[model samples]
Target: MPGEYGYPNLNDNDWIWGGTLTDIETTLTHGIRWEGSDATRVNYMPAFDGMFDAGQVAALTSHVLSLSGKAKPNATGAVLFTENCAACHGATGAGLPAMGAPALNDAIWLYGGSEAAVRKQILAPRHGVMPGWKDRLDPATIKMLAAYVHSRGGGQQAAPAAEPATDVAQAPMAETDG
Candidate 1:
């Protein structure tokens, strides 16, 4: 599914992946966790069912829900979140893009944002995957698509032009190696 996952606009620099044109191109060509791209990206949040007790999960959910001011702060939940989730999702739940985590402080979510939805996710994590287009599109065409995407309003400024290096000799590689 090419769903935007409720993320902010792509052209405005809010990227789980980097926002450079090359970064966007790589994402499009390889896809995330899809079999087609030789270098597909893949990361997943672990399900915390057995990892945390019901009480702890409840607390974390409370703290996370409270981030959007949807729930009142619960000391137990706040403590649990600080100890367990602060690593990937900043202490304030701002989310660390390098770890493929999304901000929880904001209402935006890949999954629904209700308490029930949040709890279910904690108990059973879900990961979204994008299929790669390299197998279906030529590099030239893919570059064209990237250009169009980069032209969007959310697109960040392109990196300064670098000296064109001689094309590194390379040969076509197999897909799905491993």
Candidate 2:
């Protein structure tokens, strides 16, 4: 009777209901009646069990490897960052904590360091809540923002990539005393 709750087959006492219940009764035998009709009627399958094929696994692994190193700056990416992200995240991707910005250079990611994770973050910024600490602590006792940012395990400063030679004018040099 419990299985009659909103189940179309059970509502109409259809053949499917009788067949399924019979099958379950035969399989579970003595336990079926006391266990309730719902128990015997449920058909469960995991959301992701064996979802990915071998090709998908290989592609995902390769994508992860690609994001581990410094991201190659394409002109479009550079322009997009400058216009949208440079104000908060520095031009070099160093995060500014005053604005609650997080460093993109680091391998240590709060949510996840995967390429997919990064893409999701860019698509939707995280909005976390914290209690007001201004009334609880003195300004001098507040922790250094830079140190906190560094403790998050930011990536090492990567050297600039070499560029192909192009025509350039030589600048007049001013000698400086040591």
Candidate 3:
């Protein structure tokens, strides 16, 4: 009979004694004589267990290096937008505020000023509600709508001029409604 360990079972009489000779021999040879039994157990050696190989490590290192400082987009303005922005902001960037879209052309920015900030906004889509213009307007109407918006300066603009220090110091107070 085959033992659970797959070694053939040997009767005691098969060896020098009547006891199960294979088990006795194994116990004596490994457990007692040389302590080879514990060493032969698969779980005893962790190095043999495969996890991350050399190629995988190298690939991971290369990926990390590649991502370092190379993620900034080269595309900007309409080109940057049409390829990336228009889907949410509308072709003209009029913004679908009802869809949480803020008009990009307007001076108002929910986040803040700076190209970096705008880039962040472009990378992450904001969720909001808006009436589906598709349902309300036909394709030709939508096209005309986009054309009208584009005519009204639909792209990004140059950086705003800096305010003179004196102007900044004497800036008028904004009116407040009571």
- Whole-model lDDT per candidate: 0.70, 0.35, 0.32
Q: Output the better candidate (2/3) by TM-score.
A: 2
After the best TM-score superposition of candidate 2, give how far the Cα of residue 65 lies from its true spot, in angstroms. Answer: 10
Error of 1 at 43 (Å): 0.9
Clashing pairs in 1: 11-154, 11-155, 12-154, 59-77
- lDDT string for model 3 (1-178, tens) is 2222212123111211112223232223333212234421111111211333544333322322222222342233324344333443445445432122334544344454344444333344232211234444565666565444333332222224733323321322212100
Q: Poorest 10 consecutive residues of model 2 by lDDT?
A: 169-178
Structural similarity to truth (TM-score) of each candidate: 0.74, 0.37, 0.26
What is the TM-score (0 to 1) of candidate 3? 0.26
TM for candidate 2 is: 0.37
Model 2 spans > 4 angstroms off: 1-70, 133-178
lDDT of 1 by residue, 16-99 (tens): 655667877887899877877669877677778898888888888888999889999989887787666666565677665545
Cα RMSD, model 3: 36.7
Cα lDDT of model 2 by residue, 34-111, tens digit:
333333322111222143454443343333323346444355455445445545544545444323344455454545
Give the candidate order by descending lDDT: 1, 2, 3
What are the runs in model 3 whose C-alpha is more than 4 Å off?
Answer: 1-76, 124-178
